[model samples]
Target: MALALALPAWASHPGQRELIAEVVRDTGQDPAALEALLDGAQKQPSILEAMARPAEAKPWSAYRPIFLTPQRIDEGVAFYRTHRALIEDTARRYGVDPAYLVAILGVETHYGRITGRYKVLDALVTLAFYYPPRAAYFRSELKTLLELPPDHLAGPLDALTGSYAGAQGWGQFMPSSIRDYAVDGDGDGRIDLKNSLPDILASVAHYFAGHGWVSGAPVAARAQPAADARAVPVADARPQWPLEQLQAWGYAPLVPLDPALPSSLQTLEGPHGPEYWFTFDNFYVITRYNKSPLYAMAVHQLAQAIAAGVGDAGP
Candidate 1:
């Protein structure tokens, strides 16, 4: 028998009943509590509007300036410096580059300086119920939110705020990712990515390690396309072609690559026509963090800039 209580009456949507029933079944949460939670969630029109104009859809020229600014890079370096011991320890334990971890934090929330203000429950509920384009996906995330334990979060579920998409903390991990990959690096017996810098860094490294980040491998290199070179069809970020095959097709890297190394040709719309690069295995790993090639490239470039000591400005 499903638990029911005298919940106050509220306006309902088409799928709310089914989702509430499912969540109740899955989590054994009282249906009335679930109902009250959803009832309190307000649909935000801006969330729907923002979905149509994500930064990843922009050209490299426009997108690069947004994330690769001197301020962001400098802040990333400072974050790395402040957390050098923890970052290095986490990187050694996970075999992921510390720079990439720092870059992800930089790109996601400007080193925790801007981890969004919208309530996570509000964002998830609004998108799950109101956004039809990705309703199924957001609905699944909403389900995950219901299933998350209070202890696993930085704060209470209703108070937790993040990206409009409901991603949380310094790394902006979706709720599911938080449930699976978040860690308690501070040894306080709690995983709080929002305020615990060590936990956030470790969780970022843990996510990359879980996704197969190679410790010491080149991510990508500039490739010169021959005059006769034609862009190859790319289905996804996975490195599918061997270097020998790419070289034979006139898409050769500026630096020598292993003939046996698997690679992929990524075509980007740069300010100056089509730009191509021989993206390596590590680049593909970065894509698992974010499905967008643009996002992956931004992290890559930001990591490079920080590693090269270009970001000297104090935060």
Candidate 2:
């Protein structure tokens, strides 16, 4: 015989109380204050639905066209031109390509134009409690948000909005990312990634530099696979082999590169057939910003197009 479990009698979720207690103990915030704040945060079912089907879930064929559009490229170029001095300065300081930094913002929040409309508290609460897939991680971010200083936030705590996953501001930095990597680029004594372009640019550059952005290093190159070689495409972005070994395993770059450079053979399904590319350490660094290979590729391709002056024209 099968038995069903009975629901608890509390009006609020049992976990809410547990979470409040955990936060109070870990952060030393008053339990009453935490509970009062949490009482205002509503559970969002739509956020859970959105989390289930992220854009990264799409195939490379579908994902590429979404980000590498003519309109976005044109806008990215305009943004780069408008902030040329800041971009160049930040790039010089961080040892990252200016085009790449612009592309990160362009891909992330569209150069501060579309930084999401969901309340950060609502999104973080919904994901922290309701979403079991990444509840632990989101719960940690919730703690970080609670610990954020008022100076770093622009307006009221509840007024801030960002991505469904709780990333905020122009660069869509997570709570922990903001705490670790955010900088006061404008010299106003506060880091605001939402409205402050300097802060956003500096913060993005700092993030890339922290993750090992090899200045002037090649990101990726088209590789001609050997006819008889077995395909061993990498699913993750971490470079696992040196260039010479990848070449021996049937992946040869279209352009010449140092044999000692670290690389990995990456493959994606193109409209025509299986496409191969030799991704370098710099390409892997791009993936640190976003885990998917498609995301990194889109950013790389967009940066390349911008560097080549492809504005309002298709890459």
Candidate 3:
């Protein structure tokens, strides 16, 4: 839908341009201009490196403390109170829970404090150019960025100031997603993800709905695994191991699990030796973004904390 128009002249990447031109053949627009935009994205270096950082495969224990802080929880409550109207209204409209939205904001940008210091264009370009592992995917995102009309957002800077991975705004969405699902929630005729709480809140809700967020359903469960279970990657490595299969392997979930769903078996470092959980389908869905179980648990736990009314007036 984004490539249905002309894009402004841009400093294009030569090789990437040609490839994008072929890809944009039937999109009803100027292929040369689209090529130019993709070309500009092909020359960034840092973006590629960001995609392959050491943090990507870090364990859940290592990832948990990075977020899920007392400070973050306190900040989440304050953010909730300050933007209660937009958060609540967006939740009501989208059927996505409000605490999860608030928790996502808190985890992603600290309610917009540190969304990332990289220029989004440079980041996307770098990844698409040099990050061979996910190069094709990021390259498509760069295409989405160039395919959309610029307007006052015509300057690359509007979409460029964010994560080294090129995710923009409080919820850290890719530029393409921003273009597709972003709503003008504040009636300003523009969806300013960086500064508009309404837009950010609405965007968060929309993303969850797009991802099949089932409101009031459990995101994850906490349980201890038996000593005998050893992780052997199987067919559905991303999903949790089914409780039946896991029990056969001498691992039992403290709670009942849906047999139809696949699961991921994770053993976490508990206070003593280890603790474990069979991550559910929804948990795997959450990890699709970051792929770290700890990050998902932190978000799930933080959301629960907020919903439980943490402190005086839940703050």
lDDT tens string, model 1, 1-315? 122323222235658899888988888999998777777777777888888889998998788889999999888788788778888899888998778888898888888899998889888988888888999999999899888888789897778999999999989989889888998888998889899988898899888888888887888777888988866899878999888898888887887778788899888888888788788788998898888888888999999988777343211
Ranking of all predicted structures according to TM-score, beginning with the best and ending with the worst: 1, 2, 3
- How many Å off is the CA of 264 in candidate 3? 4.4
Those runs of model 3 whose alpha carbons end farther than 4 Å from true positions after fitting are 1-13, 19-44, 151-159, 229-249, 253-264, 269-272, 310-315
Clashes of 2: 0
Q: Candidate 3 lDDT, tens digit per residue, 1-315?
A: 344324322343364655566557735677766545443443455555556665636665666777777888888888888778778889879877778888888778888999887767677767776677887888788767766555313135534678888888888888677777777777777777887778788888887777767666556655555567556564432664565676677666576666555666666664455666666655665665556666677777788777665332211
For candidate 3, the 10 contiguous residues with the lowest summed lDDT are 4-13
lDDT per residue as tens, model 2, 183-253: 89999998898988899999999999999997888898888989976668576978888889888887778
The TM-score values for the models, in the order shown, are 0.93, 0.92, 0.79
Of models 1 and 2, which has the larger TM-score? 1
State how far residue 139 of model 3 sits from its true place (Å).
Answer: 1.0
lDDT of every predicted structure (CA atoms): 0.84, 0.84, 0.68
- Model 2 CA deviation exceeding 4 Å by range: 1-11, 310-315
Give the top-scoring candidate (TM-score): 1
Candidate 2 global lDDT = 0.84
Q: Please report how far candidate 2 places residue 179 from its true position, in Å.
A: 0.9
The better candidate by TM-score, 2 or 3, is: 2
